[model samples]
Target: MDWSQVNWQPQIGDPHFMGWVTVLVYLGCAILAFKLSLNATHCFKQHIQKQRTFWGVVAFITLLLAINKQLDLQSLLTEIARTLAKEQDWYDKRRKLQRIFVIAVAFTGSTTALLLALYYRKIIMINALALLGICFVIAFVVIRAASFHHMDHLLNQYIAGVRLNWAFELIGLALISANAIRRLNKNTRHRASVD
Candidate 1:
């Protein structure tokens, strides 16, 4: 199998299925974001800038996972073989570790999203969601750091323009969480003053 000679089409391998899932999940997140932050701001029309920003961050993380599915080891090997003028993976020891990470994150994300739906007006839920994100990122980074050689030198190499996107997403999540905390504090102060 000549990887160099192989054609890398947009519909390559499992990306087709995973890409669709990503799109659907992102769209769902966007809708929920609008609803969650609808009353966030003092504006009249209900502009959830905070929620919008948060969802964008969520979309970025989910995007990374979704993209990882198709661009993983087995699929990339085929692409590499096609482009490199030969095939590889003789030992069948493809790193393919991204699949595990994706499964973990997806399960956490989906489960939390469903739980959020149940607690639409609860500030505690937002705090819990932020904690969940923190745990997942920390666990993943620790695990990956420990098992660095499993995948290629850099993770998410197969996807274009998604490099370090998860980092940015984490930063965004932190910022929004801070804002939510501030808002919670201010509301508490106002209630205290009234009492």
Candidate 2:
């Protein structure tokens, strides 16, 4: 229980092939979302400000997720909590604590999403696909955070030699990218029509 004896080095949660692929996908999605946000900024169209806010949030979230994908910062959080539980003589009650933590995370995430959707209702209708993608990403994070043994095992399993986690994460990134490309194209066409 000595804090000095504990290893404080940073660890790579997923250093294998599929992990890097997931990171790349996250970066790609972030770039696309950032581009979409910039497009909104340079436009004079209706709801431009709303679109900017939505895409800006998406870009920022994806960028942070990209960094987290490789760094596995969440593991550090888990480790800290574990240490605290042991020090407090409540390590045996960690299961209950973890359950409560996961439920709280789920509730907070769901409430935040609902509030955002309501606040950006018009933009949500326009970028519903990206919103869906965001939900998928959020769900993946929550599930991962839960760190349930069976769920973790399932996510770690190989699907046609590709990690299942990669599939789940990439699917969400693909949706966001697809929406960004679609909106950018639509904007281009709109400018053409205007000219």
Candidate 3:
């Protein structure tokens, strides 16, 4: 396979289109998170401190991820890898080892998060988010494995353009936004009834 013939640039489909869409979704979710934070502060005064902190973190993280996706951080990492490979003959081996390490860490972290979510199953949103996190981890693993094995065709086909992984990410962000809105509406109704 001619590596030079490969389209390294983002194209009109899977990944690029999906990536931009994901960015938009993340932005909306970030907005929802901020709104949730405000509602927590103004309406849910009983749990004001905890709710505000949680929603604030959600907003921050979602906004950061939106920026990261827009920037295409994975491509940047790939460029860094290519540059390091040019400098050192051992870079390829080191890169493979690094990939293995990342996979291990992702597996461990996702498992721990899932377990914690199970323990806090009363929080429906946490369970949903944890499941989404697991899906992201699985997608990451598939992409990494494809890259390591020189399965560029598979990566490009399933993971790159209108990428399944990016779709999962967008779905997760949308879920967060939807859940936040639902909770806010519920709280608002409760407060109105009490008043």
Among these predicted structures, which one has the highest TM-score?
2
Where model 3 places Cα greater than 4 Å from the true spot, the runs are 1-18, 41-47, 111-155, 158-165
Q: Write candidate 3's Cα lDDT for 2-61 as tens digits.
A: 345333455332346666776778788778778877776333345565566566767787
TM-score of each: 0.31, 0.89, 0.65
**TM-score of candidate 1 versus the correct structure, residues matched by position:** 0.31
lDDT of each: 0.45, 0.82, 0.60
Write candidate 2's Cα lDDT for 1-195 as tens digits.
667534445767679887888888888888888888887733446779889888999999999988988888766666676777788899898878778987888898889889988998867776888988988897897778666778899998997987888889888888988988888888888777878
Question: What tens-digit string does per-residue lDDT give for candidate 1 at 92-119?
Answer: 4333444554566568766766665554
Off by over 4 Å in 1: 1-101, 119-173
RMSD of each: 13.5, 2.2, 6.2
Evaluate residue 106 in candidate 3 and report its C-alpha lDDT on the 0 to 100 scale. Answer: 72
Q: State the displacement of the C-alpha of residue 187, model 2, in Å, after optimal TM-score superposition.
A: 1.4
Q: Which runs in model 2 stand beyond 4 Å of their true positions?
A: 1-8, 41-46
- Local error of candidate 3 at residue 66 (angstroms): 1.4
lDDT of the structure predicted as candidate 1: 0.45
